[model samples]
Target: MKRPLLTRLLALAAGSLLLSACISQPGPAPRATGDLGLVIERASGSVQLIESTGQSSLARIEGLGDLSHASVVFSRDERYAYVFGRDGGLTKIDLLEQRIDKRVIQGGNSIGGAISQDGRLIAVGNYEPGGVKVFDAQSLELVADIPSTALPDGSRNSRVVGVIDAPGQRFLFALFDTAEIWIADFSQGDTPQITRFEQIGKQPYDDLLTPEGRYYIAGLFGEDGMALLDLWYPERGVQRILDGYGRGQQALPVYKMPHLEGWAIAGNKAFVPAIGQHRVLVMDTERWQQQHAIEVAGQPVFVMARPDARQIWVNFAYPDNHRVQVLDSETYEILADLEPGPGVLHMEFTPRGEQLWLSVRDANEIQVWDPYRLELIKRLPADSPSGIFFTSRAHKTGL
Candidate 1:
């Protein structure tokens, strides 16, 4: 009780200093991870997380179902990835934690999926069950199941392809057997506003929606033309473009089906691969008419344009699968020819189109290149990599 005044004054000053420190101190910042990229290992049923810049694998996630034709769509924040597997397994992967958060088997066979414009729903296209299923993006809960039952015979099953998100909480897809285009609007309620445009085309294989989300184009497998739907004016229904494009021409045996994802729009023109043919159908988007056809070495599998629209890159099917060619978008001249070796499954371009990444399955490697210079920069090892998807696609319309 007989403490000195100096001791009491020192204690009071220490208390004041501690209070000031607590008020001004800050917490640790959130973890700063690099731009993460995923490489789908087709045969091994695993995914390799790699840096988009460094080209190094950071982690590998396994136990994903049959990944033979797996594709991934990322969450709006890019923290999670919803992978659509061929064996009907939908896996929700946490990119930051490098593990599976939730998984479910929704069907017998699934092709691909798309995330909604609002980032609240995930819709998958099924081949076995022959319909599309919508799910809650966060919990992966089944929300609605719209079976493709538009066949003439009243069959409850019809394969759905090219399931893609559209504006106004809607989805656009094609029926493989019924040759119809169906639009499901979910903005109103769980019972979607369904709009069916029948007889759109013969055996519509795959479709692509324009960057502006205005046009939905589907390629016909039974015929040479493609069906175009003006989403802005749904009253016009579907119009056929480039009719009889393969007329009077002998077709080649396609070892691998051509993907409409290969189709690209550069400036005012769209470059489309001619099915069972060795040419690319160039169309003027404004008029939707065929402008010219450029001949290539083999049947084109993927025909994509550079971001700047200065050039187009074309990949071929078997017998010519090992070759890749670049073309001048304006003059249609062959700019470069590259043989990146066999089993080249897919390719992706940087946002600015400055660089390109290609997956070579048989070689078990991913190749990065400077397309303008036609030089290989990096070759990273992979396990039968089939698809190279970037997080940058999260904002795009028709990814």
Candidate 2:
């Protein structure tokens, strides 16, 4: 006559996951998976959790020390969470336990995370050494280390600037400051190797692969334009992107902060953070042409698009104009630039595209903003260098 405890708990978990996917969502359509939730990490090295309806919870982390910039990725099977830290260590978070199950030391400065579509392998960006080290997600064993050099210099140590997984392309792409793209093939059982590593963008900033995974577009802060590299064509392993930063007097500072800090692609547009220029460049992805520049304030540090369909959000590094500027995707105009507080760094929109969560370093708090009204929604107690994610089920939330 009464529901069992296990049945009740399972139902609650499913509901939580669905609600999480829609929390602070930005896009047009609501998530079909209503069991989602959010995971946030602070720069001060703490992690937390948020429910579907914007309820906050405590984040639990284990075996992580001196975490710089880390990323939390949910395994496709939804059994475990693969968390990587700046200390070059990997922690496997068992979903059932909701705590770190094991730790694997990577021995370097880690950046973000990239995993194969199948969730078999993981690739992490190591900055100081400027390389991408691959590991077996299940075993956490060293698979292969893809250095910044595809064609070795034999002299200077190559360093990795950016790394991301291209699902449509089925390969892991890593960007080096020296202007090269390294790909780890995950189609086979063997360890992923550097199949193509050659010069592509001009001192490429962070990179992102198109949804189709045909081309890799990179921001060239060193020059006046961005770089569009032709990937996997094989015949031409690398080509200078049509519209990238061309150095000299004519070249404009495309990014607001250092190296055009906040660059991103939304639908058919490329939003670039012109730090010194105090603006964001909207480029047509199809035409590969510069559309128009939307002006912001201070130094734009990150470009975070509302997880919705219409507007894109931008964040600034400098306190003088630390805010989240929302732009209409259609007209590419600055609709609203809302200031939450001082020192708002990178940010991400909830899967439902309702709220904009920011990692406020100096303020030592994670501020949630109403992307539409441009008002401060709430400020959660968080530290520096933390990460935020959306999920369908209940997980741990850190402070």
Error of 2 at 85 (Å): 2.0
lDDT of each: 0.88, 0.61
Candidate no. 2 TM-score: 0.77
TM-score of each: 0.93, 0.77
Give per-residue CA lDDT, model 2, range 1-399, as digits (tens).
999999999999999998998896777763232333334454444455444365455455545665655667766655566777778777777654556777787757776666666667777777646577777778888877766653255664455655666643245444555666666666665556456655565566566565455666665655555556555574566544435332232443333334232345568787766535666777677777767777676556666566565777776654554566778877877787576667665676665677766767667677777777777778776655345665531121110
The list of candidate 2 runs beyond 4 A from truth reads 1-43, 128-130, 147-156, 175-177, 231-234, 242-267, 392-399
| Quality of model 2 by C-alpha lDDT | 0.61
Off by over 4 Å in 1: 1-34, 150-156
